[model samples]
Target: MATTPVTQGSTDRRRFRVTGGRQTSPQQPALSRWELQALLLILALAAVLYAWGIGHAGVHPYYGAVVRSMAANWHAFFFGGLDPSGWITLDKIPGALWPQALSVKLFGPYDWAAALPQALEGILAVWLLHRIVRAWAGPLAGLLAALVLTLTPITVALNRHTIPDTLLVLLLVLAAGSLQKAVGSGKLLPLLACGAWVGLAFQAKMLQAWLVLPVFAAVYQLAAPGSRLDRAWRLLAAGATALLVSCSWLLVVWATPPESRPYIDGTTNNNPFTLAFGYNGLSRFGDDPHALGAVAGTTASRTSGNTGWTMLVNDIVGPQISWLLPLTVLALVLGLLWRAGQPRTDGRRAGFLLWGGWLAVHVVVFSTSNGNHGYYTAVLAPALAALTGGGAALFWAEYRAGGKRRRALPAAIGLTALWAVVIDGPHGRFAPWLLPVVLMLGLCGTAGLWSSGPRTTPRALHSALAAGMASVLLAPAVWAASCLDSRYAGSPMSPLAGPVGPGYREMRHHGTKPRPHALNTPSVRDAALLNYLTAHRSGEKYLLATQAAYGAEPLLRATSQPVLVMGGFTGLTPYPAAHHLNTLVSAHELRYVLLTTRRPSTSAVFWVKQNCTRVPPRAYGRIADGSFTLYDCAPGV
Candidate 1:
């Protein structure tokens, strides 16, 4: 086959042949033996990173409760309800948890079962990223991307938990792959499929998934084999399909009468659109006063610190996701600059822009958002991995040609190592020897790359390249491994990895496990309360009522019996109004209410205190510090 050379080096010349507008690399064999081995090795690493010791992993109690409920009750499953009785919906959409719920149904709701889907999704994401990068660059680049993604600290941490973001990342990566296919084939079907994938991702995460729409549109419009007008119209059609798919569940809930379905959390009017666009979407950027205020006042939000350009590299987020930011940014800039003279539809440039845009959009959004958790940055892993792998491949090929870009490879290695050491500085007490090893590898690799040329032995060149890659990746690998430590077990909600605080260090020093988060591991007092309520229950529709999901989550996880969350996640959702509570009490459908002792009570608490008798802590086999008041709401109590 007559081929067009894509790379300049005669020693390792790679050629691309375009046929029927699809770009195919003639030099790279399909699934060569070495490639297959590397692929399998990377997958094995991902499996170990995401699935090891998951049986003992802690579950996020809020989502865990929903998964158990959804597994048992189709009503709760369809609505993504927080309780078995489907009384109230969770704050976020339910699609991401669907896989975990199904896993629970098949495997009996064990922690491993709930966590199994994300681990598998994470592995699939790695494989998909490899395929896409390999198609654009070569097998070596693909394998490196897969390996980088596999070892991303936040990706490892998120996949080990039952959280929405894991599924979101998987779906978004799938969407990227589909968009790549569309770019290659210039077909309507692939574009539509890409839209459908993003729409499905929207279900996993409301508006966050749509962040890549601009990237997808730009890449396809700039790279696809069609007139600009044709591509523009096709994109419109795809956008319509995405909107329809994204609104699929919302329409169902809207059609269901208020009395027939659970109350939608995080919205005043119970409208699904309001919840999606207002509470989960615009509020993330501080557009809605109430939602933003509630989010800002949260304990997790308070811990996230202020938002700014430096947030991603700050103490809270750097170790989890920023380990590769320097390398990734340099790769994007240099790769695009080198490819500037290529045609608009150049596949290599398209790959750089696609992944680079993905990383850039997320950086701006996450860095400037009102509040976000460390695990939220897991979405950036695939992009960073792609840029690193593809850029390294481009830089190596250029370096071998004795060109001006030869310094790019060594500079990337040096910068990556320097950033790794800087990030590792604060955590030096935890891994003192790590920085020295990383520095040595980086220095040696940079020197080797700087000196070697076409005259260098193949073995020496490969060794130098391997050392450089290792220097860039070692710290992230270590940080990712820290997720499996017992001292980090309590953070399923946040899903943070590494030495989070002095508490983690203290636990590590003592060789002890930290206490479980309050929302997951119920206290002995909670056990006593559960026992007391169960003993006195009399055909009540609800076992008891509590102020918010936090108070009710552990109970829901412990049993299938329904517990009403009076105010949703925060004690301010105004769900179960006092009149509703009075109605339930008068009808003998709710006989108990649990209220915290904090002053300035909500209306539900006020009603319970006025009409219901307070049960002494002595009745439940404990002395009270006035932290909580359990009320007997039975009629005429």
Candidate 2:
């Protein structure tokens, strides 16, 4: 019984070809003109939404301080002039000051100057992702990836605020994009551009540039096995170029006078490069007794470190919205597996690997280094979005394959949407039925992808699928927007309606001002006493002694009275002088001693309180508020 021979052409006709693969059929065109139009429309919509809310977001107080200080002291040739009182400490990366300074020069002294650059960078990042993914993945994947990034909660928040993270992220993404193009096309110019971007990333955040490099190299090697050595050399050259570009300012700072160095070194220190590159970098990794009050000081409490990490992650990724948390983990796993299988075809897979690797490196380093913050996780978000996009695409494809499988997609989307509405919804009111509505939409999308699967389908279904993906990506953004209106826009429906919330009710009843509570508030009578000194002394430079003297620098600078805060680790200031100040405040220059009677509850506040006793009571003024006393340290009273 001889079976009829199965012809190759007949067999090929029956097989279902994956979209964008080698299989060709006249019936199924690669991508309809309409699909391309839909994708572009989605990209445009995502860009507008991401960029729109940036100006309105509340400013981060610390970052705001950094920007203001830089703006107030901007000069054409040298950045900010020397720390007036020789008490400078933070001078590690002069690069961080330039951009803010440039913003001030261009837009005048406003918070918007500092923030606008980051917002623009964020929009550019979205555009880059769209282009990169569209080049490699299909339009569907490109649209999904871009949408996910645009509406990501953390991404939106960071874009809106003035912080280094957004700049770092933008530069990192650009570097990744350049590297992707360089590896794909084997172009030296792209490689050189990649180096320049890496340098920009380094200037933005110091040493964090290397986080993305290894992953890019690894992915490139895996993707193009034959050209591994050549790729490695190109990457090395790029890194060298970046190092040269980034370190130019530092090299200049190193050659400047010690007095001149106070602006870059922060303190009257030996070498700016050694202090910043060494103490600022290595000391952060290792424990140091002299580093107290510094960002990485041993005396710095765990809470501060943890809060930093938490803020970092929350700003980059959406707040671990309870409903999305588990799904995010699953998505990450699926994304990695999917990319692993796909390998590096057009640098898309490599890009994913680089992002994932960068995120992982920072998480491990910070988590283990006794310093971790949620905001640090921002670096990983683009990669996470890619993963989520891939996972969503895979899930949709599976859902379309079988009716039983279809339920899972709806269930997931329903729960996520329901969670958003319940916790992040416009009103406190719970809409239980909204879950079903989302589930129905999910079913519709599944049907669309299924019917459109490897064959023809109605244009509306394609549009619906694209819309659904956009909605998914916008989930976090919409929730955030709702929160902003509810909290900041005078909406009674805001979930934060009680005493602890932001508005008239909060300040009128709770004694908590709507303003950010800076450490220099007059709540400490010493702060008031210091203000009084500014009134009386007028123009005389004074050294303020205390462990956390720098805490009051912004206030002191406001008075145009130079002050050197004693007894804290150097920040804004260079190392040796920072170390000297950490040891003791010279009583000759220290004309005013601010003392707090009570120990501070938190570590930062504690540092402020610890140095208060260094001044002699005989030289002090009458106690104000029973919590603090001010002393006039002028020679012989």
Candidate 3:
């Protein structure tokens, strides 16, 4: 080998040359062995959190319906058992069903089988998030981020359920992380992977996936200095890949015969392709503004139009979860300040800004839209976690630079741990005692700033402090897990002993009743109905129809039946009569109708009750001590 000693600094900023055969600066310490072990522990905890109440929780009803529906109808929509019917009928995308269907096929229609994948995915998402943040910001930031997400109340709740939200969260994190990598390296493969992740996200929840990419691209553009054309080309490629991946299902559906379409409601346009792309795609932004008023029982005529910005904000952000408002505002201010102070060479600062910006965009867009759901706010967890991590990192770094820096770190850690104990400790249930702990954490951060010593003290102290804060944040989560165990240990109603105010008491009463209660025991009734349909049905080739859209999951579970609701898309609700049911009933296409008392007014039940002779309610077995009723719609007589 010819020996040419390498220089320490190369003229080319982009290129790296080994100096005297030494590695170009030791690899940055992303995760120490201890940090790795801690992360694995956190991941294990997340898995347990997601898996503990999988089958026993009331959340299973909705997922059960999805599994049962897919098992029964996969052939009808895809293989031609029910001619003209497709695989899914909900207003949502078909991406969520594939996992559920696979679960049913492998695990034999078990609710846990359908739910376990989501739990595992949720854990994977948390782990991946930790890895991404740790790589960029160091293990401390990564640990804080992971802990925040692990303890998030809504994140924990969504992970245990079978809905698409958790899956979407996982996909979004993966896409964002891939985009972060692609932006750094400008490699085509990472960008393509980013596109594929976004496509999966879209498959999970439709166009919400697209909303995240622009935010990521803008961050990349600002962080990386490149020709405008180059950036544009990369974005275009990524977009094309995303579209290709996301539209694969739509393409399959489009190529199939009209009779082979598995879903109802949104499936029947003069041009199914146009309807799928445009109406289902863009119409949601317009339709969601009216959903709240519609939910509140206001007529479309009486409600403000979808374009009204104020009403949109009120509907989506204000009522969804009021706790998020202050935290979001604080995070934005802190994120901007953090970005402004950082040196340009510190890529981690840019990553923080980008993640924070992505979070802000989610809040802003969702807030301005007409569509609102409490769970939709779950997307903000990563941003909040990052912001909290950043704040804590800054505080800890400052604390580590002082003469009393050694003491500072321990003091901060001790104070934080004490706060967690006082506020969230089992004995601290009295509301009056909670204020001092909050005041102490705030004072500790404020006091660190006024200290004459170096800034490192505050950063190290806050890092330790952040971990303690995460413990406090997670106390409710620990309690919730214990409550779930208690619920499963005896009766589902046993967990209700602690909270019994008017609202919950009413819910308990209604949940115990035979009729459908949307809030509490909807899942129980749904599961029972699914079981009843499955035991009574003879053929693997039966078509199941539901007037109630939300009830589709339970129904699906009971019979391993395919449903007629809109495939999980945005505007598949109030399922149209002249278009959806009239065609199916008149053609005598469906074998059975699983009617529930919980049907929304726009459901097929209302229409069937009005048009067809009411069939007698057949006794479906009870679940959670509540009864489910099944009805058979006679062939067109």
Residue 345 error, candidate 1, Å: 0.9
lDDT for each residue of candidate 2 in 53-171, tens digit (9 for 90 to 100) = 54454444434444445554543214333233443434345455567556755776454565567667777787777556554434555566677676665565455555567778878
Global lDDT scores for all candidate models? 0.81, 0.50, 0.53
| Candidates ranked by lDDT | 1, 3, 2
Which of candidates 1 and 3 is the stronger one according to TM-score?
1
Q: For candidate 3, write residues 1-637 as lDDT tens digits.
A: 0111111123111222333321132245546689779988888888777788566543334444544555555554232221123444444455765676667567765656666777888788888888777655556767877877876655665665566777888898998788767655556678789889999888877777777877777765655334567767877888899999988776776677755454433433423343345444544455442232222122221222323334212322222122223333444464456447433323544566667777767767765765444456667777766655554554455344433322433344344434444323333432334445545644554444434344456466455455445433434344335324322111221111112212234545675422221212236545555556566554534456654444454344444334665323222344445356657666666545644444344445555555554334445544322222344655553
RMSD of each: 3.0, 8.8, 8.4
Q: Largest TM-score belongs to which candidate?
A: 1
Task: Identify the leading candidate in terms of lDDT.
Answer: 1
TM-score of each predicted structure versus truth: 0.94, 0.68, 0.70
TM-score for candidate 2, residues paired by index:
0.68
